[model samples]
Target: MKRYISIYSLLIVLMFGMVSCEDLFDQKPLDSTPAEDILTNEKDAEALLYGMYAYFGSEASYGRSLSTMLDIMTDASLASTGFSNQLGQMYAWKINPGTSEVGSLWGNHYGAIYNATFLINNLHTIEGDQDNLNRIKGEAYVGRALLHYNLVRLFAKAYDQATAATDLGIPYRLDYEDVTPSRSSVEEVYSNIVDDLEEALQLLPVNERYDEETFTLDFANGLMARVLLDMKDYDGVIDHTSRIINNPAFSLSSGQAFTDMWLKDSGLEIIWRVGYRITDANLVAPGYNFFNMNNVSSPLLPDYIPSDSWVNLFNSSDIRLSTYVATAATGYGWTSKLVIKYPTNPDFASQVLGMNMPKPMRLAEMYLMRAEAYAYTNNDEQAVADLDALLENRIENHQGVNISGDALKDLIADERKRELMFEGFYWFDLKRMGKGFTRVPQENTSTANDLSISADDYRWQWPIPTSEINGNTIIKQNDGY
Candidate 1:
């Protein structure tokens, strides 16, 4: 009973219109207003919806943990010697049901879900512009789907056609009611995600020039493409990616433009990015885990540095080599290659360090997903075309490659690693592809030890939080927890 009480604390806080002292929800506490009267007009609904987005971008979600966890958990990066140990437990693969990070992540995601659900359930009661109302409703649906999609991927086994129906997934919360529900199957959760995305497409405006912060038609399609890829629906992946690829508003960034994208957080390739402002309370930069700039002379006090093997994968000719990786002496003796992907945005550099916005969906990923889907469907010509198209934008003087069969699939996987490393995708790719890897110790770092993770390892599916297990009578823990 005590365990159950805490599990619903976040939902109750949201439902009661109370805001935390830390401003975690980024909204004024409706201390004077009744919870039932909070969403009495369009203005109230809009505020609620914006608050949901704020929480989604909070450190507990994409601003930090969700964006960097899997990257550190796998071989993409390693904790440096004498590091701050911010996510050291995850870096060492020492996770359990009682881990604080796991619980915080779980609570944060559900908190955002509750906000979205509340707006979705009550928005219809208020009268407003039909278009405005629809837009808010649509964005809420997309937000819910996006949160659940990430939750399912992290908590359940990789979507296996034969086993997905039985695999436990995080509960797909759709209402504001206080009820403890059993975990849904991976298949059911995914089905709900798809339905939400499809519903978003119908209600969201069809403008190509939508704000990077808002959910748009392109964002919904791009997300659907990603979801379909994970489910191994090749035709569906291709179909959805093609819609975004054909849009002229989004194009792959290259050369100086590409470098600026990471440093300044501006790019045409970005379909949806969480916007972070300097004025926001308790702002946590997504890239701070990789590169925390202390001062001009040393500048880097990174919690995690790029793994040697991953750094070796990039060629000097590739623009990503320069943009993503930089060598700097820590003033502690040794010079190491650091992940500078999330360096300070120029506008906020004076006030903050390592403050770039998180770009979750990009045009480059669309090309990668389409290429992989094409390869699987035996469309070798189209697959190579898509691969070379992306490579040409990324690699300098890139000559086109003629490859097919397993070779094409391998190339696509490698390219994904190169393009998306540190932004988070390493472990999930391994899980879905049924592959394992060994982490070799980095130089001069006793903390960096050799660890091999097998595809069949139970740790691939994160343990359900112990609090949830104790609170919800029907919730089952993942295997080996």
Candidate 2:
């Protein structure tokens, strides 16, 4: 069992660097040490910040495992036939407090939150140049908000304007605390997210140097666009994404440039990507969960593939079909179309398995968000303009056309699915829209029943982990769990 630390003790140990607390989720207790006695420098402070990123990249979080689990939760993909049975219940919508995925998700997200809290609470003490210190703090705040937003959406009910004040949201951990805290209201959680993002916007660099991998002005704006979109704030979505879309440094990539963007690290369209190195041992590269025979040789079988329903969503003329999907060309006939979105990082050695990076927010998503916002606000003219702008680069010799009303809305939603599938947005998108899914029937299994979930199904909200409820007395489990 891992040990826990009191809030006060952890903060002191963090700066002193006397404890082996590199991992954010480290449950081990640390010996009390004085910060003044330890060597506090910029490098030590930056190391802690990078550790937070490592936590997000862990298998339990954004790395291949979390992305794959979320994909299976939606209709876009499914757990491969031969993969672990632990996720079988998730794909089948049998989630409960006992579900390990629920527990893992809870743990990983909170772990990141705690890491951010430690940095934000104590980083000011580190002797660094004033500008660098403020930038680091801004990154911590934005990172905290990102983790909180993701946690709230999954653990709490969808953000309903009518019920947000009373709806149960995940604990908004912004400080170093060891006490079992109760869930906050959905409204409160979102408010905290916005406050942090706004602060990040002011402190972060408007134009970041190439060496900076931390969140910058563009990333903050893109994230707020996403959060506001979930909150049903269409006008706010446009406001933030416009800041990013109108920037000269970012734009939509077409043809080969778009294809290379996915395979390479940095690109014009990338707003911010969670990076990984080739030598990072046991790294849970999100791409590793997808098909890449060169790196992954296990069961010699792909763990997850695009469902027939998802495959049919793309058109032959659309560039995504070629860029995102590939033929398996081997045994394992669950689905013919394999995922290549996080294909291979060609810059790394072919033998490397964990080189694929996770792009959390990008320029393309901003355009799509802007289009959705326009569609929601009844600005169909501008809506269609944004849609066509994105599709022009996505499709070959795209003949631009205008669309409006319900037709325009449906097209925009479908376009989002095509543009953002397998990047961990499908399930969240469905939740925000209050839509459920029925998996496209598998051709290989005539006896198999297609999984169906209705819009009002209770399972739409995942159960809070049993361990948490047992430990935290003030915590109330979600209903019907």
Which candidate number would show the highest lDDT if scored against the true structure? 1
Model 2 segments beyond 4 Å from truth? 1-39, 79-86, 209-212, 292-300, 333-335, 347-349, 352-355, 445-449
Candidate 2 lDDT score relative to the true structure: 0.72
lDDT of 2 at 77: 71
Give the residue spans of candidate 1 off by over 4 A: 1-36, 293-299
Q: Which 10 consecutive positions of candidate 1 have the poorest summed lDDT?
A: 1-10
lDDT of 1 by residue, 1-481 (tens): 0011111223344453333312322332354465568888887786677667766566667777777767778877777775776777777778899887787778677767767777777787889899889988999999999999988988998888899899888888776343567788999999999999999999988864557877888888888988999889999999999999999888898899999999888889998787676664135777776655544345566777888889888888999999999988774567888888887787767655567788888899999999999999999899999988888988999989888899989989999999998677777789889998888888745464578888888888888777776666667888887
The lDDT of each candidate is: 0.78, 0.72
Best by TM-score: 1
Model 2 per-residue lDDT tens digits across residues 1-481:
1112122233334432222212322242122344433327877666566656666666667665446567656777755654544456776788899887777777767766655776777776768788888887888899999889988888888999999999999888775344667888999999999999999889887676344256787888889989899888999999999988888888898888888887885678887766666554244556655553444454335555678778888879888889988875534644456777876676564554435677777788888899889988999988888888998999988888566899988988898889888778888888888898887656432211377888889887888887777767778889898
